[model samples]
Target chain A: MISDITLGQFFPGFSPIHKLDPRTKIILTTLFIIEVFLADTPLLLALMLLTTVIMIGVSRISFAVVLRGIKPIFFIIIFTAFFNIFMTKGQGEPLVHFKIITIYKEGIIRAVFMGLRVIILILGTSILLTYTTSPISLTDGLEILFKPLKKIGIPVHLFSMMMTIALRFIPTLIEETEKIMNAQKSRGADFSQGGLIKRVKALIPILVPLLVSSFKRAEELATAMEARCYRGDKNRTKLVKLTYKPLDFLWFAMAVLLFGGIIALRILPGHISPDSLIYDILFYKV
Target chain B: MKEIIKTKDLCFSYFEYSDNDNVNQAKIDVHALVDINLTVNEGEYLAILGHNGSGKSTLAKLLNLILTPQRGNIFIDGQDITKPDLTEDELFDVRRKVGMVFQNPDNQLVATIVEEDVAFGPENLGLPREEIRRRVNFALNTVGMSEYSGHAPHKLSGGQKQRVAIAGVLAMKPKVIIFDESTAMLDPRGRKEVVDIMEKLNREESITIINITHYMEEAARADRVIVINDGKLIMDGTAKEVFSHVDELHSIGLESPQGRELINELNKAGLNIDTDALNEDECTEAILNKLKAI
Candidate 1:
């Protein structure tokens, strides 16, 4: 029952990228996202895609797993593509000869490009961020990054403390829900066979007990914390201090170069014609 | 002797609601614990004996400051628990010193991974990562759960989960670990597993243990047995002294161990036997010796 949901969700590895500091990973991911946003042309977007593919290769995770991560966003991709293709009005030559629905070269180009960009963005970030770093280390990185927020009286320490607890409890609560479901099922509460309203009514049995247990758990956790002399912001020290290494510097350099290349391409005074052979073959056909 | 915990005129009243939703209207205060005075000597292994609703759990909660006395004072390491001067932090400090392990091992465990759950208390203390690691290892080793450190708590048997829960409390480095019928939910094998860990912790680590249980056999293993009936401290003494008063125990809706009953039957059936046979092995040996004598 407790094993159903995945939390932390990290694939353990000894790879160089996986071994990098979580703060470094977080920074590099942000850098990659900036580069993705700056990517306006096919060439620059291909570079971003190449980096993500290389990341997936280096992490040694199966391609199927990476693709599985994209499954949830498939609908969003389709929705945006459909909306952009049909709704975008362009003054350029109409490509499709249909009644009241004219597909322009510009609209078709805009839709495919927008769809590809969103898909790539989601895939790249998922591989770099959530699928790799453990939640504990992620929180460690966040706490360190937001340490400066303490100066502005933001209580960054408490913020991280809350994050750690929340992350720690997600799996716990999921496990509890599974247990409660099983217990209710044991008592002959059939959750599967019902209409929408009946199904929701059946869920009340699960939800109420889950809520009660979670609160009880929170109370117990608080008591346990108190027993350990835990105060939110006090004399606390971390065992692992996030240290940026030479590899991190190399990553930063690569990111800057990528961003520089994108800007160089975008700012240049040359606009390629809509009939660029590669753009049509790669995106328009789909 | 340093009195680790003391309560005077302690009483607890839980409400019985006719309707679960209407807490305000149909609430009747059902007295859980009555006026009681008890002292826990430092480093003592005390087992509390009572049937359900006999106030054993109420007493355990009161000692840990999880449930403050409604009509009395509770002292932990000599500090009054309900003092106005005691901040929430101080109360936490008191709780840390006195950790509690509840009945359901599943409910008590809050983390998916065993090691992470064990480290929860130390992490809450905001200890250095190294220190928390050290405590987790120490606690796991104390409960003989070091080998299962990486295992999932849910994958564990009922007994193993209870051990994990104990390890979690142990990581807090609490001076007094209270088991509030912690083993009641487990099978016999699981109960023995938890009791063995408790035995080792009390014997070797000098961690005081207060086990509240309905099982009189468990009380047989404690250094002292305290019987609570309807919230009153009816009896307090060594295992033999308490268990010998079988009639008194039976009067309070409790029973001596099953082996005790077997011995009484054997003795009544024209066999010379010891009624003080507190454990199965001892009772078995006594019966075999009597058989040889005949």
Candidate 2:
């Protein structure tokens, strides 16, 4: 049951997005996130949504899979929307009044905008980053991006090495956890039929063994690594080098255009205001 | 033959901390290896046999420089490695010359992808990108894991994962490879697969092999066998010479191969059988010859 997690999931493909350099994808994902928050007007939000949809299409990942990635955050999206619709006071007439609760046109608009922002953020990062780039390349790109931090006494390479080892061992540890859980269950341990506190208490039997075995694995792994001539990142070379290609530059330019468009929309005159006719129609202004 | 590895009066000990809460408790020094003099020639297929806690693994680690000897000296390619003044670069050079494949396949693999893990050693050596790629390819092909190069290691079976670990060590192009009970965790088929690779590497590639195992059948296949017991080297000889001391081995909690045991049993039953047979086929032929004479 624990193996069903989609964390750091990568769908192998020969699409253009996958072909882009991991560093480019990482930077673009950050830029896309910023654009998601900068989108205040309905037109801007629609543009962000369209771009995310286009990216998902280009990645060739099934739309259902992308939606499944958002499933874990479904409750968060709903809670955020509900909280905004109830608590947000707006300079407009009430849409509905029930007892002490009054909902406004502006409150509903803000809730829709916030909900779309969260959804677009998840979909956009998942398509460009996790879905397209493998975990190895992702960590490699992060290491390179954070290489400057090393000058400030930050152990960037060490962090990346730790991340790589952690990723490699996650499945192994998960399988071990399942085995331990089953062994305990065979001994008549009840984990599923317990209250919150009782369930946590039941996990102690599994956690103790898992922790002990992990320490053993760590010691053995250190010995094996030292035997292989690993001496930290000093003078170490990489088999796969990340080089910026023409496609990377093209994506960079596209990102610049998107950020520029968002800033332009924010600073421009009254031609496309947030309370325009499109916003009224989209938000079902009452 | 050139001696690739040599040890002189090597001694190592682990300090076991007592569980007592006394502030002035003395740390007990448990000797793992003591006064071991051994030499390994280039391109030799030697097996080190010992039961658990017999200090065989400590000897392997000493050769690989994973653990320094508390007292004596180790020479790799005729360079004394136990010197206090040995530089880090020199230490790395020695390690590159002597690679090690561990017992647990899961802990040895550092990369998620098979090809990347194979390239780990070469990458640590700071080789050029093209050279690293070449070595990774060659190593994977050597281990017959070329098709699984792109696959995740966790998806592989135990034997396949162990093979990948071997490929990871082979990528460094070491002159000597140490199997520190590498097959102990494997099933019968997995054990055979790893033992086959060891033989292939020793015979075809001329790489020196030092396999540390408790399986007598595996030791019977080696050119030389050394027995360690309680932190001391007890017996060192050819496979036939070592297995002939069946009574002595039994006293130390070790058993001879099945063939030797059967020959001994037949001799005790008032039938003369050649005790020289170390494997089943040879013992079978000897028994058939005695039967035909009757």
True contacts kept of 1: 0.35
CA lDDT, candidate 1, residue B177: 92
lDDT of 2 by residue, A111-132 (tens): 8889888999999999999999
Across residues B156-246, which tens digit of lDDT does each residue of candidate 2 receive? Answer: 9999999999999999999999999999999999999999999999999999999999999999999999999999999999999999998
lDDT of model 2, residue B243? 94
What's the distance in Å from true for residue A62, model 2?
A: 2.7
Model 1: number of backbone collisions: 3
Residue A30 Cα positional deviation in candidate 2, in Å, after optimal superposition: 0.9
Q: Which regions of candidate 2 deviate over 4 angstroms?
A: A97-99, A270-286, B18-26
In terms of lDDT, which candidate is strongest?
A: 2
Model 1 C-alpha lDDT per residue in residues A1-286, reported as the tens digit of each score: 4565566457777776777788888888888888888776667778888888888897888889888887888999889888887787778578886997877777787788888788788777777777888777788798889889888889987777778777666756777788888899999999889799999999999999888987887787675555445666676654346788897788778778877877877665245565777544433322
Task: Indicate the docking level reached by candidate 1.
Answer: acceptable
